[model samples]
Target: DARRTPPAETEALLTEEGLGAEFVPARLGGRLTRADLLARALRPVFRRDVALGFGHGIISLFAAGAVWAQGDARQRQEMAGLLLGGGRATILHHELAHANAILRHEFTARQSPDGYRVGGRKDVIINARRAGLQVVYARTEPARGPRSHSVLLLDPARQDTAHLRHLPRVETSGMRGALFSGLEFTDCPVPADALVGSPGDGVGLALRAFQVNRSLICGVVTAAAGTVLHSAVRAATEDRAGPVARRWHKPLAGVFADLLACDAMATVVLRALSLLPASAHVLAAAVKYVVPDLLRENLEELATVLGARGHDHASPEYGALDKLVRDLPVAGLGHAGSASCQAVLVPQLRGLAERSWFVEQEPPPQLFAPRAELPDLDYSLLGIAGGGDFMAASLVASADRTAALRGPGAHLGALAGAFATELRTLREQCRRIPPGAAALNDPAVVRLSDRYARVAGAAAVLGTWEGQDGTDPFLTDPAWAVLALTRTGQRLNIPVPQLPDGVQDTVLGELLRRHREGRSCDLDALAYTP
Candidate 1:
């Protein structure tokens, strides 16, 4: 339970496994060919420990994401080489500011006769002390406009040691194994070629990188939630004959459905990064905002099942559950906070409400198919503002298709119709909001954004169900999808119809089967030896 960096042996093992290559592109001589597969590869690490996942190399991947999005060919090759060689890298932001604002960075880099002279301090940086390469965000111009800031790729090995200093490590209540520190540069000179993109492209590059990283990180953290749920299920099964245990069964089934819904949304967003890059910006933001909320709520419900044992760090049976509960919040706050993600959606709502809501074409079925092959990810296609929201369009189309069903799946049509109505209401609300008022400062605007995110999540679930080809029996079953939609409708405060008699039993049975069979709680359903 001690808060410290990951043990040296664990770090060595991760390095030996070449985990860093997951962040590098295959074209650049690394293993990173797809974003969804990268998340799948990182699951074993997150499932074991959130701190180890962060401490080992996620921060390096976060740093490399920006370079992958905007860096030149030489920069990409250099970063790929660094990670492939087991060297660490990190991104230095000025502060934990809102994602939508034009940040006036305190970290500045002044132009000089031959190069730039950097002089500033950035705090709360992950891997700051251990990083050999730093992607520093700094103000290059005097103005406060978007063009004033630039991202500089710095090599501490080449810098003058006397001018650069690493600050003390910052301790946290969770994810304690992560190395959180700061850096200060006093007139450190660097070559002009260190820039990742053209002058003033830092903010744009950062936003695009956030689009990819937010989706990837959220997908990885789902494994941690699954781990906690497994613990709760084990505890509940101990008192199998008790009335309390029986009551917990239905709630446990509900939570499992929530986890599957989260996985569906995250999986679709990750695949969308490659297949539908134009629509990924808003979809990424929505997933980042919604998935954590669902996972956190699931964690809270599971905590009730564990009772006081959930808090006992000394109990070997439940100690990991307590640690995961503490670590879950930290994962939510990383990269972008919930408010920042909602802020990203606020301004785009009006545009989407006007042009894309019901007018756009439905996204291709492959956009939602988890097993389908995708186009190679092109970071160049990642836009700062989404051109359209095909996911929402797909929801409307799915509702129409579901309404035609005549048998056991009939209730899903009503649930899907409720969500479609929710979308139409969201459109009207967005249309009524005054231009430029859809900002973080307005509580109403934030609420609208939240509702929009939930609706988008519903769309993800429906699209996933519709795209399935009966390969996985669990995914193809309508019981889980019905419960998933019902739970979402509850969150939206809509009057959803009562679920069929045996839907809960079917879902509960699957949850128990997965636990007994050593399969993952999420949709991948990969078998394990535990």
Candidate 2:
């Protein structure tokens, strides 16, 4: 009877429409062009129930995507048979401390002529016990650097599950359906082809999987919020209790607004996603960062509406509301979990901030330019022994002031127009510091370290492009990342002395204050202050 409680497996399978045309067709059934749809479906399921969604929902999406997006036809059919046949339920993640299902290993494979064995453990796997199919993400080489990972779908029957039997079962307050556990590979043997992709391509493909996971996490949150809104409406209309009627107005309004906003955002992202083959690291990062707030907001309002009813086990609202509270946090955290997602996002965004090229002019360029000339660029190399040293030092230069970029220059365009904003950011950041502390290498010093790296790279590159190159070069020059980093550094209270007070930097300064001290968001409420 307990097993009959319906994990939504049957229903979701019935709903598996494939990624349709959205996914890149690999061995996996179909592929998703954009990551947003994944989030859209996930939000509802998660809000409905976190544990089941993540535990089972995660595997389903991957199974589907693996077939559609990651799997070659052979892989897809193999997985399709098991999944469509009703036999797979194991998610092996967290064991490696990353959600990177495809990154490779620094350690090389160990083998005898007879066969080879994988000898590490997958730290935290979901639904790990007795799964017929195991989705194992492993490194071909130990310390294979970050990018050398891969995702492999395996038969537990082949590798050793002896370790699985001994893995400790974990207890969680929310999303308990996941049945979390760890794994150990003790002389585990597999055929030579266990590799997911060429070793180096592991991280890239894994990233694809993670993007799907993170985006869908938004759906989980939305669902949680929607459920709250649904319940509040029910209470306001049906419950006769004076308190329920009186207090429901504002909370209900908040939930309703949140739901609408969620839908709008979802639509925008989904449409945008369809146009791309897969979500980029930056786009995925943006979604992961913003959507969590939505989920948290939704759940908090749901809690408020339920109020006294929230605590009573006997109350109809108790189970779902309590579960919602537990589930919402998990979505924010993500599959490999929150902290892991953050580490990945922070760097990816930082890269986007640096590499992007833009100009804020009186009249923005035509609403749509041929997607060709993006951003800006400029660079020129000198006529040296081998080639010309780059001449432009103002807009571009080498890190140590060596190696001038040469011409027929690929990196030059109208992008230098941002010189005005870039200079302002540097000046402001410099102004914030007490004068003498502005070192170029110090991450804390705005313009000195990574902060300056963006602007400096911008200036250096743009300066090099003295004469003729197409307008296209400027569009893609990567000065945006520099400006963005400096600005954020300042806001975080981390000084980017090289660049300061830029609007985005200001936000970073604010964030730093929140991070170092108490977060300014109502300490009394979100903190659950007694």
Top candidate on TM-score is: 1
lDDT of 1 at 388: 97
- For every candidate in turn, the CA RMSD to the true structure comes to 2.4, 14.2
| Model 1 CA deviation exceeding 4 Å by range | 1-3, 95-106, 239-244, 332-336
TM-score of each: 0.95, 0.58
The count of backbone overlaps in candidate 1 is: 0
Q: Residue by residue across 121-239, what tens digits does model 2's lDDT show?
A: 64455566646666555555556466545556667776665532446875555555556566667666666555454444455555555555554555345555555555555445553
The alpha-carbon deviation from the true structure for residue 361 of candidate 2, after best TM-score superposition, in angstroms, is: 13
Tens-digit lDDT track for model 1 on 245-288?
Answer: 57787679999999889888899899999988877999999999
